[model samples]
Target chain A: MPETIRDPADPRLDPYARMRERDLVGRSGRFVAEGEVTLRLLLGPRARFRAESVLLAPERWPGLAGALAACPAPPPVYLADKAVMSAVTGFPIHRGVLAVGLRGAEPEPGALVPPPPAPVLVLGLAGLTNHDNVGAAFRNAAAFGADAVLLDGPSCDPLYRKSIRVSAGAALIQPFARLGPGRDWLALAETLGLETLALSPGGAGGLDGPDLPTRALLILGTEGPGLEAGLLARARALRIAMAPGFDSLNVATAAGIALHALARAQGRLVPRGPNRGGG
Target chain B: MPETIRDPADPRLDPYARMRERDLVGRSGRFVAEGEVTLRLLLGPRARFRAESVLLAPERWPGLAGALAACPAPPPVYLADKAVMSAVTGFPIHRGVLAVGLRGAEPEPGALVPPPPAPVLVLGLAGLTNHDNVGAAFRNAAAFGADAVLLDGPSCDPLYRKSIRVSAGAALIQPFARLGPGRDWLALAETLGLETLALSPGGAGGLDGPDLPTRALLILGTEGPGLEAGLLARARALRIAMAPGFDSLNVATAAGIALHALARAQGRLVPRGPNRGGG
Candidate 1:
């Protein structure tokens, strides 16, 4: 049976308390997952996270019985009424599902990255600091079969609570790591044998242009300022041929398009499922 | 000269005040624009919205001089310091750029949709109620040059503040209209000579599949409970080839990918020129 906590101020609930997302992220490698969708993702087979505990609205406790029973070793599940939940979280959590999970030790960026002469697709984020964008990129990376994602500062933490929710919990499952406090992200990618393709609005080659290398690292920059000039200079600039007059697609959307194209070209993407939608 | 208001409660500023986003959206056609990027888009030359009034943080007032001067009939630009801005909005709006714009009268859904014989591309929102998703759909519509967007009942307002912001102001300029509250959305598209291709995870045809008609209406549903069974039954199903294990892409990203493929197949997308990225 799960624990029932009538008090909103239980000291054990600090991880799911009214702390800001920024403060909660990357703090001793613990993170919060919001909503049932993300909670399910956290327990996905490939997730590199361990649920420390769950704070669930009472109504949800029954519905989650099957999921709980399936956990390798069920974590503690705390039940709270809506009023207590509101008081504890500083706001109403409409979905009423949140879990605090600890990330397993992730390898250094250098280790997970593939070395030269290998056919691979990897996504590298440079100064892409919005948590939602980072989360969305991670989701897209997974969708398109990228090997992993590497981020360089000052990028927002993908494990930030909102990011975890936004990427639909892809940030938790997708293999990702920090490149560092200071590193020539592009040079490092090249050393890993990735031919960097910097996606830009104005580029020298269309996404469909000649001979996209079998081994590629697609680098994206922040939305507004875009990739740094030096990074743009180092990478072979590639553009998605968009309708004229529009400057660019949203950074995350751009990533989806670019990743889809590159993934297909490198023979990574494949059509999946029953392959039919019918009543 | 822009109006300088010492009072946040100035009578002229109600449009920019703390009204609920739900109440403000489509209330006599007025909509809020948030952030610097969207405010600029609202003032773009081809915009179909009239700036009713603008509330600017004191710091941003100077940088916007050129944009303000260029308005066809510049709306009152209300200048308020951060404190006043916060008190009025009941939150610290870090960007300090918010404008209320009134949309022009819209054409009927029937009028904007392409006829059977025309070469075209369009997006349809069946029940997409999330403001961000709706907004992103509009932004993608604009990016790929879709003829228009159609929203059926139960969908959120595209003019909602967050939608407009997420759309990068695409909602202000992209042509969109509500479909029948009761009529079959799919039947209406078929009648319009559009080959209705519903984007679904279980879709049979690869997005790159042959004979993607020139006159096509790609319909999308909410992320979770996708297109209603009846609607899915009435349309041909289409899918994006993605890596295995993932259930689906975010609605917005899915829109970008689907739209890109459909648009390209219809010869609606042309890879633009110069193809150059420089430091």
Candidate 2:
């Protein structure tokens, strides 16, 4: 059953208040999932995060009824009028669906990469400060069947609301862990015997040069500065060839291209039935 | 030399006023270029558009001095304080550089994709309404050395300021044509004897299937509703394989991956000198 919340000041709605501000500092250990697609992802069988509660406009109820019913451990549902919902959130809830998800314990980076011979594909993101890029990286990682994504301390949070939305809910489902501040991810990669392929414009060879190792980590840096000198030296550097004089593709776009190429080379992409639409 | 302006209401700055509003209806036959990099592109030798005027915060003048000096027929330059420039633009001009480029004429679709004999790769976009996606598409097209980009009427304007910024000025450098409202672009592709490959999740084969033809057009559609049935039927359907049950990649990311593949197969990517950075 759904509860009708008339007061914007209700304590139950605390996590949903002033979303923009909360996104910056985050909601302690909780994150928000927005829109119908993401909300469904939060409650899906493969969901890594547990939903604490769901908030939605009265109109969205009928559409989400089936999904809400399917939740094995249904979270509390709160229905509010659009006006009150907008007032509480400090912005218009255009999607009219939002859920608070709990972020459990952080996963260890070494466990994410595993020892060699496991046919693992891991995406390493370094100094990626943009939420959109982080989100897109997760989306691409999931799409290409990457076993995990390891982010350095400088990378933005993949669980941000906008990141979750931009990722098409991959942020919720993709297996990822952040290497705590000042940790050497490269040293970790070396210890695990994972082939590290760092993407840089000045890289020696093309991305299509050779068959990618079954266990490999594709590292991408920020757009303008690219990878640091020390990092590039340690990894086998690879570049995506571009037309003369052009700088580079957007960081997220580059990740997508490189991941696709890696997945194709390693035969990780799933074959689908004919005539089934991607969406 | 740059002229200094004191007032935000100056008639000479009319085109820049209320940029958000101007972006919707557009500045008649003009488009605004933001940031130093895009400004440099507008004044570059291979520029397709003509600069009507350049607006800058006084602080930006030093950085742009060389590019301005290199311009063959320098347009008038106006320098103003950041406050005055921001007021005139109805927003804070953080990049402190803006240029109004003239859209002289629209090129015919056929002219963009030449006759069959010449080796060519073209990108065709249909109903891609997002400015960021359009911009990224242009960036990928430029990076991968596509001959040109042809956008249908339903697609957003690649010349939009945000699009231009996102494209890293590729919108200005890349040769592109809008296939006017309701024009049959597929028919035009047929007339040009170009092989058409439409990307869809339900695509019959993987993207790496066979050697792509020398003259090929890779067509992409909007994210959710993908390419239309009629269009998909007319072109060879291809897809990027993904992990099971995931939706699709961001339209722009998909464009980047597809373009990179096509460019690699066609030997279009430019090889760069060792130790040269992409930026």
Candidate 3:
């Protein structure tokens, strides 16, 4: 049986307190997952993140027991009524379930680039500060089968609670690396033999029907100012052919389109099921 | 010179006060534009929407003189100090600019399907209650040169303030029609010579590569539970090939990729600029 928690101020509730995205404790490598879908993913995402504990609205406890029991070492489960749950979180905990997790170590950014014969597709995200955009990008990358994702230049933590939920828990499973000053992208791409492609609103190269190199690094940029001028110029800049008289597509949507095409060109996005239609 | 206003309770403030999306008066065909980009689009979009009046913070007037001056018969521009503006709207009005415009009359959903001669690419949206998804869908339609958009099944008003803002004001420019009770989509598609295609994850057909008919109506369903099973059964259902274990992509991102592919196949996504890349 799960422990029944009556006190909102219990020290064990620290992970749930006033947890806005900016104040999340994910920097220490621990993150929160809200909603049953996310909590379910915490148990079996085919990844290394380990759930430390869970708190659930009383109604959800029965349904989630089997998944929790399946864990090699079962995490403690705490049950609370809605009022106490809200009081503990300092906000309405509407999703009815939450899990705290510990993400395993991220490898060196350069190490994600596969050596020699194996073809690789890696997404380089730079200066993507918005948590939702970062999450959506990861979701897209996962859908398209990108081998790994690397973040640089002020990117948000993929483990940020909102990022994890928004990504449908994809952030937990996808192989990823965060590049700090210790890792330089320019030298790294060169050493990995990757043909770097940068998406731009305006560039000499069109994005639609591209013959992509076998080993490609598709780098996305900051929302408004876009990739640094030097990076845009240094990479093979590609633009999504947009209709005239309209502003650009939303960043996440643009990434979806670009990733879909690139994944198809690399044969990573081929049919997993028989009914795959050619669109 | 623009009119200077100071009172939050002024009769003219009715349109801006406590404007929750459901209570918005945009159903009467007049809509509000927030932020500079939306206000600018209201002034000069190549669409039939006409700016009726504008409200601006005093500090923004100097920068916007040219766009306002270019209006053939300038709409009255109301200027207020930041405090007065915030007070009038019951929230922080940080964008410093707003405009109210009158959208043109909507045609029957069937009218959007082309008559005998011209090719048509239309998007039929059903059961999409989220304003952001509706807005993003319209923006993608506009970017891909979709001929028109049609909404059915209790969809929210496109001209709702948040919808307009989220769409980057594309809602004002895209030709859209809402279906009334008497209209039936299956009948409408057949009458217009359009092949109806519905997007579903467990669809009979794959979405990647296809020769889309010139006159096609691509319909999207709700985020969860999807389209009514009856509706899915009636339409030619298509699925996007996703990676083995990941959750499906966000609805808007899925729409963008599907729209890009459909538009490209129909040659509706040809670039207006020099850097056109065929996806």
Task: Using DockQ, give the best candidate's number.
Answer: 2
Model 3 per-residue lDDT tens digits across residues B1-279: 799988988777666666554344437656778998887777773655888888999999999989999877788899988788888777788878987777677777766666866778888888789898899898998888888989994888888888888788888888899878867778888888888888877676766555667788888877776777777778888877766667368887888878787877777654535542321
Candidate 2 C-alpha lDDT tens digits along B1-279: 999999999999998899999887853799999988899989999789999999999988998989999999999999999999999999888878999999999898788876769888999999999999999899999988888999998898989989999999999999999887777757777888888989888887666756777888889999889998888888888887787767468888888888877877787777553676533
- Chain A agreement with the truth for model 2, given as TM-score: 0.95
| Model 3 TM-score on a 0 to 1 scale | 0.94
For residue A259, model 2's alpha carbon misses the true position, in angstroms, by 0.9
TM-scores, all candidates, are 0.91, 0.97, 0.94
Ranking by lDDT: 2, 1, 3
The prediction achieving the highest lDDT against the true structure is 2
- Pairs clashing within candidate 1: A203-B275, A203-B276, A204-B275
| Chain A vs. native, model 1, TM-score | 0.92
Q: After superposing candidate 1 on the true structure, give the runs of residues whose Cα lies further than 4 Å from its correct spot.
A: A6-14, A21-26, A80-90, A114-118, A275-279, B1-3, B7-10, B21-26, B55-62, B76-90, B93-96, B114-116, B273-279
Instruction: For model 2, name the residue pairs that clash.
Output: none
Interface RMSD of 1: 2.4
Sorted on TM-score, best first, the list reads 2, 3, 1
Candidate 1 CAPRI classification by DockQ: medium
Evaluate candidate 3 and give its CAPRI docking class based on DockQ.
Answer: acceptable
Deviation (Å) of B223 in candidate 3: 1.9
- Give the runs in model 2 whose Cα sits over 4 Å from its true position: A277-279, B271-273, B277-279
